[model samples]
Target: MDGRHSRISVLMFPWLAHGHISPFLELAKKLTKRNFHIYFCSTPVNLRPIKEKLPEKYSLSIQLVELHLPSLPELPPHYHTTNGLPPHLMPTLKKAFDMASPNFSTIVKNLRPDLLIYDFLQQWAPSIALSRNIPAVEFLPTNAAMTSFVIHLTKNPGVEFPFPEIYLRDNYAISKFQNVLESSANGIKDTERAVECCEQSSEIVLIKTFREIEAKYLDYLSELTGKKIVPVGPLVQDPVHEYDEKPGIMEWLNNKERSSTVFVSFGSEYFLSKEEMEEIAYGLEQSMVPFIWVVRFPGGAKVSLEMALPKGFLDRVGDGGMVVEGWAPQTKILEHSSIGGFSSHCGWSSVLESMKLGVPIIAMPMHLDQPINARLVEEVGMGLEVERDMNGKLKREEVAKVIREVVVEKAGESVRQKAKELKEKLISKGEEEIDEVVQEVVQLCRKKNRH
Candidate 1:
């Protein structure tokens, strides 16, 4: 059992959510090609689907490690992930996750990997790693623009963010961001957790962003935190690995004219309220644009699409629009030639997907860093935001107008072209970001060994 292998062993742990785990998995895949062996760890519930996404070649380089959270009455084993958990149980889930620190400690001690790459919320992970003489780096799956904005607000309460383009204007969004910052679990607020995680990072904080789009934000984030902000590129999932096999959805996309249709999805975690859903439904109908909308409800919720959406929605938009219940192969849909625009909630992962695939965005941010991400979307010229009222309520007219312009109007030509150019630029860069990431990570591990 002597350490003779050249491959670096890394234990990768991300938050128990599809968005966070996905980037970690993609980064793991990238590192595997550079002589890095990843022990991918997450709850059994979250790991099940990820197992299927891994190709046969990655089987040896990447090993799935089960992280068992204690079973709580409110949060059962199945609810270990944020995928289908009820909205009200979010706090319970976070508390349960905090309670699992001791369990994670055991995994770290037993595995004794040379390095640990952990998510933002779990500051204790780095603490445990340091105790075992293992260097831990924080890998934030969110973009730098939003990350810097949050940090600026926290550090300079009254100071205005230097970058005015990325800001929350609506009162509703501003209040929502404040509420999230103050929201606490286990007697600690989310902001405090983020600060601690950043402070504990070995020397560099690895983030999911590239310099081309966020060079200033990255530099400012480094200034604020005094940690080298190393971007790991987009870490986009390969469309080939997305083997869910949605033949029906793909066939529908195939029938649409090139760049004639829009794809509407609000990410896996967010479930729109009935009022919001009705407004969006009316907006989509009014836009007269062909769309593939994927609607999701909370886990175990009995509300069907017919019940959630406006009555007769299915009948009225028949053939012109497709309303899919639960899940859709989003990556596959975006890669299709027919998907001209994406009406998205601007979740970081979804934003990156649309950007990488050259699909312009009609940003309708819901909450929690999304509004900021939406602002970045517009700032980058790859998308336009659907303006909301002063109170932050979404209007059907505005939604319809934005959807039409971004997908069909001549005014949107620049944005569409910008998206296409971004896709090409990303393709040209290839794995450049990951190479820097590998160098920083390997150097950190070597430094730890020397100490």
Candidate 2:
């Protein structure tokens, strides 16, 4: 081994979604800045898009490790969009992890790295790293509040509440729900076994969130784990692309009154059904707010919008609205002056970006950690959740109500002010702190090597 070399391997099971992959990749880039060699592993299918976006300077240091899985049968007719994985694929992913563990073990042995950092879903990582005497850390792309909640749930089992229900309960009750979800999901049951694997093997749990923002919950988790819990985050930054400026939206925003526009994006991963799309469109039109709605084209099993939107919906909105299909420059859009509020699926990266921009949120959490994020945002008095019935179908009126609450009500102003304050705090810390976090990780790895 080259004693002076700062090398670490990062394994990520991307699970066919950009939301999961992007933050992990960002963390890898951050580590690269600290002179660490990163072995970025993913499925062959996910490599293509990442390759297109990666800058030339860092390309050599980031190595791609590809794993091939037998293609399962096509997704069911009703649910094939990017919003979520097919239910059957969960077991398939578990099986694939089991199959890949030995292969990953061989890679680690050959590379002989000092540390292994992996995503929450990679069940084999902790075991493989531990067997080789390397320290393993779990990188959660979700908010710290959710991480604290999950960790709490894992320690104290048996709490029953959906995300919204939990939020309605008192602050302490919310804490209990967090613990319940974590323990139930990562407890003695089938799902909890993987978390058990991580807890047993890992030396530390590294989360991507700020300690100042979620201090109470972080303290709770630190007490429960009896291990160091580090919060190294707001891990996302605006990608420096060379494309021409898309300032047209800003000009349109200036024409409108302040806080008049509602920005609707379900992130790159979630897709709306034709029926759901129509409902959203009609609801937006009914609400009479100037808006920007971003939607992706027919990819996977999503319905095309050639005939789905209400008749003359585009014409009626005219300069008042814009529909950006495919990729929209999200950071710039959120930073615009006239853009008043966000309607989001509560992806952590998006949540952080919105918080940094001081935009109030209309959170419509779809799956995974989203519901938990929604609860945190609302709890902090910065946002409101659009109520969803037990069936998971969102009504148009409810959408309208939440949008009005966030965009038109006095409560939203407090949320927006708090969000801006948080953003300023992050900025005051500067980019140098980000470098320090990555350096600390490298230092930890080097410490492991000496032993």
Candidate 3:
């Protein structure tokens, strides 16, 4: 066996969202190859889907631990994740999760892991690790550019409103910016939590980005956080075979022409509002491009998608569209020869996934880090965000226009070309980021052991 990673045991605890959990799981798989023992911890329901992905071979090296979510009046034990929970009740889940610290602390003391890699939700994790003399790493699984932007904002609170010159220069205006930024004190806590975790941690800020794409941002993040920042490459997954639900998604794509269809999804955590969903439906219907759209609902939502969408929208877009309810094999769909563009929510993973497949993005960013992700996509020339009105709502015509521009029209040639070039660059770099991180981690582990 290679004496590379030196049998370091790491406890990985990501935020409750599937977006957060998936990347940790992917990292766990990669680290196990480096012979790092991983104790992958998450709530039971969140870990349920990924249980089988770990083969019989790595069972001993990569172990799954259930950290149950405490029951609250707003979020019960049955409600395991933010995936299906409504927007209003999210704070309840966070509250319950925060309350679980004693239990997590108990597990940490008992296990005495070598390192703790955690996500943004838990501000308390870094302290727990330090209290036990275990090194802690804060993991940022999104684009480095966005994280850098967040850090820049956190460090410079005096800059004040109107969203820097970059966002202001374009047709994208101030009112069209993030609601949390304009209206309330919301989202500040998460930003503070991330900075706190970074400041408290002993190791580098581990991000899911490559140097070539976001090197400047990486340096800036390091400077801002007062910690070394290590990029873990893009960490993009391809054609995930874990779930075998419907061959129909592939079948429909097979029938479409090459580079002619748009794949649409908003990741698992976000469920669009009725008006927003209807507008998107109208937009997709009007796009006139062949499309596969994945739609999700809040777990307790009583309405079916049929009743929610615009009346006659399905009948109008028939033959040219395949509207899917619930989960879709997104990677497989993106990998299809006919899949040309992605109408995405600008979730960092989805953006990277589309770019990884050389599929240009029709960026429709929703809340949180998405707006920043959208801006970065625009900056990089791989995608275009749909323009919104003064009231910050999308129009069907604009939606169709952006999709056509990204996919079929001559206007999007640069985006298409850039996407292909980016895919080549990101994919070819492969595990260079991983190799570097492994060396640093191994060194950190060995040094700690010597001490």
Candidate 4:
């Protein structure tokens, strides 16, 4: 090891889900590329997949440190992958963090890294960083709009009720059939705690969204925090499958008319139930459009797809559709010339990627801040949401109708055009300046440490 090379270690307790881990991993990779000796600390189970996914060259530069934690009761025994960390598991996760703080503190003290970057859910990291006088930064794995929404919700508690209520009333029929419970103030107390923790600590918050997209909200958040809101993102990589050969889907897509294919993926974590899967399959079949569908194997009784989908659904779609089971190159798929529309679970990353690639969206929000993302997409006039059934299930007919409207109907052309314009704004032929943002973040941490 040479003294010439600077070392920076990042400790992230991602919310035990793929959506959280993937963005953090991308950040870590970017930092590693900038000649930082990177140490990625995560749960032992979570670390394995990341290690497996890493290229041989990356493995040489990046070090993985696995922390042992007792199995979470909410997490099933077979659950090894990161997906959606259910809200009900928050208390258990908090307790785990409290328990791991001392161990993490010990590791930081021993390693003595230049800076510590953490995820939003890990409230204990800021306290640990403060104790050691090490500069820390929070990496939010969501868009600026959602981050701004969260910041506003923290400051004015009253607004949270109306936002979700308004979304439910205007977009989804679920709110009408079911008794929509207003979240107690206690529900967002953790967010307040996180903000307060940041306020007290000598750390800056680095959000993973662009200021160009959400300037006004970012400006307001910056003023409120009295800290810089650095939005350096839509952090994504070219869709290259390192482990496997490229699927012929891209070739098939290239043969089609420009912006004619609708790319459908539910992110890495969202698994559909069998009935839901069949409904979606039927809907796609009914729509009669060129589509790419990423399907995941069923997990449990909660949302099993094994029994739900009809026999030979894949065969039926045949040449018209491509069904990718695992690890589809999403970024590349979105960038494809044939991709005109995105039917998504409204994960922030997927939404940003679709928008960045200039694809209009049909948002089917499953849970979490998905509804919020859906609203933002719709407000921007580049997307539409499917109506939910009385029991909160998305029927095949509804999916078919929305797909037809977005992909087949004449009315969707305007939305498609608007999405393309937005894409042009984001994607440039010139060099991307993400490294500059990384350097700024590094410099800010150094300045904070000197103080």
Collision count of model 3: 0
Candidate 2, residues 330-438, lDDT tens digits: the string is 8877887778889998888888888777888888776667777787888766688887654556778888877887887775677777777877887776555355456
Candidate 1 has which clashing residue pairs, if any? none
**Highest lDDT: which candidate?**
1
Residues 115-232, candidate 1: write the lDDT tens digits: 9999989889999999999999999999999898888888899999998887787887888788778887878888989999999999999999999999999999999999999999
Error of 2 at 396 (Å): 2.7
Candidate 1 yields a Cα-based lDDT of 0.91
Clashing pairs in 2: 152-179, 153-179, 153-180, 153-183, 154-182, 154-183, 186-192, 187-192
In the range 1-451, model 3's lDDT, one tens digit per residue, is: 2445447899999998878888888888788888789998888888787786667777888888888767766677667687777666766777778878888898899888999999976888878888878888888887776676666766887675233423432334343344334322224366667678778867677888777767777787777778889988767664668445887878788899999999999888778888788788888887799999998877777877679888988888888999899888888888889999999988888988887889999988777678778887888899998987867777788898999999999999999999999989876777777888787777776767787
lDDT of 4 by residue, 1-451 (tens): 2223355555544555667777777777776776676778877768877887787778866788766555666654334334444545545555565566678877788777767777765567776876777777776777666666666666776665334322443434335212212322224455665566546434356666775566765676666677777665776655656525655867888887877788888877667766777788888888888888888764443433344457777778778887776567788878878887899988898887887788899988876668777877887788888877656778888898888888768988888888888778777622243555566666766675578
Q: Cα lDDT of model 4 overall?
A: 0.69
Residue 14 Cα positional deviation in candidate 4, in Å, after optimal superposition? 3.5
Model 4 misplacement above 4 A:
1-13, 71-81, 84-94, 159-193, 197-203, 243-255, 300-306, 311-316, 389-391, 429-436, 448-451
TM-score of each: 0.96, 0.83, 0.92, 0.83
In candidate 1, position 394 carries an lDDT of 94
Q: Candidate 4: which pairs clash?
A: 17-83, 18-82, 18-83, 274-304, 274-308
